[model samples]
Target: MTLYGLTAAPVARRLGAVRPARARPLLVGGDPWAVELARALRSAGLEVLMWAGSEEQRERIREAGLELAPGELLAAATGRGARLEGITAVLLLTDEDDFNALASTVLSRGAGIPVHRLGPRSGDHGVVAPYGGDDTLLAPGLTRLGVAHRHAQGAHIVTHRVDTTAGTLPDRHDLLLLVRPDGRLVPADGRAAPAPQPGDIAVMRPRC
Candidate 1:
């Protein structure tokens, strides 16, 4: 909230908090993987938004039928936009490792918002301690390098309902995100376990 918004605490209490019950995640990257994820989220009945630093990225993001976040990346993601409203979480998947780490730290600290970033390229030498591990931010093969390589090889993201009785989950697949029956959106980038109950929609990718 801005300085002016701070004074409206009593008014806010009467009106109600900004966010709704369901999750509205704001993706903070401009890759094809990000676009696919955003589309799947919307299809699953969650409102999704994306932020792109370049015009090329914005064009593709819009072409995918997603909305673009206004203002700069960190500012908008940190609730410094028009208002600290619907956005529930920020997923930082930019190719730049340092920028992702920096933004992750800032959003977690300043904004008090949940943040998830891509697996860092910096390893142990990284300036941010939390974003160092391959499994820390995202799953091993979901990083920019890994996703880019797979995208080039015809691997695409897919969303499906979890019906254990139908068959076992695919062997060579990675679970990216999960949308529960209650409209809770969960990111399964190794940060969260895959709890697939019947009738849940899962966002996944082939391990090819």
Candidate 2:
């Protein structure tokens, strides 16, 4: 299935509603991408646990004032009393494809944690499988999409009309600018909108 299909907006909306119940994510790897990812997750209000591969990388994270747990991803995930409780997501930011793939497989099977892989390359080989089970967030694509979507929906206030094109329904109009589903306006031919259900048409205007 496609990434958009895998990530249902409504599900994400619901998940975003309640604070994540899993422990803060445990990032595995010592690359520059891993450091940046830890910072980003912390900014998003999620706890970040770093598992560095080397002493130099560990020091870098320590100097940055973030929590550090010295262990590889597999070791950390498999350690006794290791529960993923409160982890919102798991990010595999390693440069090694083999490491990222193995981490993704293990997390999904072992802890049921959503795993995302970050790297500089892209291809079907890099795409995580077990289809629709876990999530993989690649560099640039996922991040860019998120940034663009946020920018598009960031206006404090917006006004729009809901014009109907069929069925004897009266034309409706509403104004909203909020970021949530209730206030945003989805246009015709918009791929971001939910899939159509029975009797749904392209010109149906959402009522406030």
Candidate 3:
């Protein structure tokens, strides 16, 4: 069973990388992930509008000097009276997974923009397609190298099939749950565990 590495290139091609000039991502909710995402997007020079769910959340975001979305989707129109059509992309970063799914569906149907969710959850969220490229700044624990804060926050367990034909191995201090080719979820602690073979699924939250 040979192992392969999955890079941002292939995923970018498949997901159609968002152009900076055309990137207008609407962030939903007031979660830490949403805050970090907004910061990252702005750092990249993209326009961002946020809907933080409550007045408190909105105030917090405003204090941070970010733009806020309208109270309701019906009021979400551009200066020229165009509806959500101006939105290039939508990101659902709420803590409620169900709410995220519902909002994503609504935005996709109404705005016709690419919608993405933060972590793995139910329903069809765009992260499954790995839309963001290497330049996409993400909250910790979403990627293999995001295990820095695991000690304080505990690890975020993520389940995914190895997209690469060559597969990958767990680094030291990381935990892995290998779903064998025959469909077995086996736990392997860190470096002691063997490399995941091709076609095998892995649940990895690296300690990096």
Candidate 4:
């Protein structure tokens, strides 16, 4: 495995770069926005597995009609076990920025499953930061809890199908996730927001 330090998660990528279409995603941590995201992803027709750090979170996940991640997955994330199975990707959404960063390390080590998390607050650039901890997701300078608070304030996630006939997307910089027609996700946040094109589902949220 090769480890690359990033303004994102700064994790070790396994031997290959071929990413599978995201059919099942494992969501780590149980924050208000994270729970809502899982609900949205499920409505979009993907199977989402929820894992919580506390029993309270577990109840919330269950109440939301979401599936909890397997028990063994906890041992794996703590660095005492094996790679997770079934889920193609992982999203670390813990409220603690450092905890999310640390979990990404254990989960990414030799585990081909792709991992993304909220950016750490350790840096001074602090434009808020986006979710790209593993360099997968992107956002502004907000911490995990900060994002949750934003969601409560009516910030939202929406998808737009690019159509040149109507001109280009108005705010490309606020982009978070880009889903290609083939189901591959292209990162389009941070300073390197990819140009939006037709036939792609652009998931966008505000910088806050």
RMSD of each: 6.0, 13.1, 14.5, 6.7
TM-score of each: 0.77, 0.47, 0.47, 0.69
**Whole-model Cα lDDT of every candidate shown, in order:** 0.65, 0.41, 0.47, 0.60
- Candidate 4 minimal-lDDT segment of 10 residues: 1-10
* Per-residue accuracy of model 4 over 137-199 as CA lDDT, tens digit each: 565554455556678888876667778566266563366666666555565433466776776
Over 4 Å off, model 3 = 1-21, 77-85, 119-208
Residue 192 error, candidate 4, Å: 2.5
Worst ten-residue run, lDDT, model 1? 1-10
TM-score of 3: 0.47
Candidate 4 clash pair list:
9-133, 127-141, 128-140, 128-141, 128-142, 129-140, 129-141, 130-139, 131-137, 132-135
lDDT of 3 at 189: 27
Model 1 Cα shift for residue 184 (angstroms)? 2.3
Q: Which stretches of candidate 4 lie over 4 Å from their true place?
A: 1-22, 75-84, 122-136, 142-145, 164-173, 206-208
Off by over 4 Å in 2: 1-23, 71-85, 119-134, 139-208
lDDT of 1 by residue, 1-208 (tens): 1121222233222212356678777787788877887888888888887877778888999899898876654453335553436666777777766666665554555444467777665456456644543323445445667777787788888888788575335667887767788766667665555667777787777887
Q: Which wins on lDDT, candidate 1 or candidate 3?
A: 1
Between candidates 1 and 3, the one scoring higher on TM-score is: 1
Identify the candidate with maximal lDDT: 1
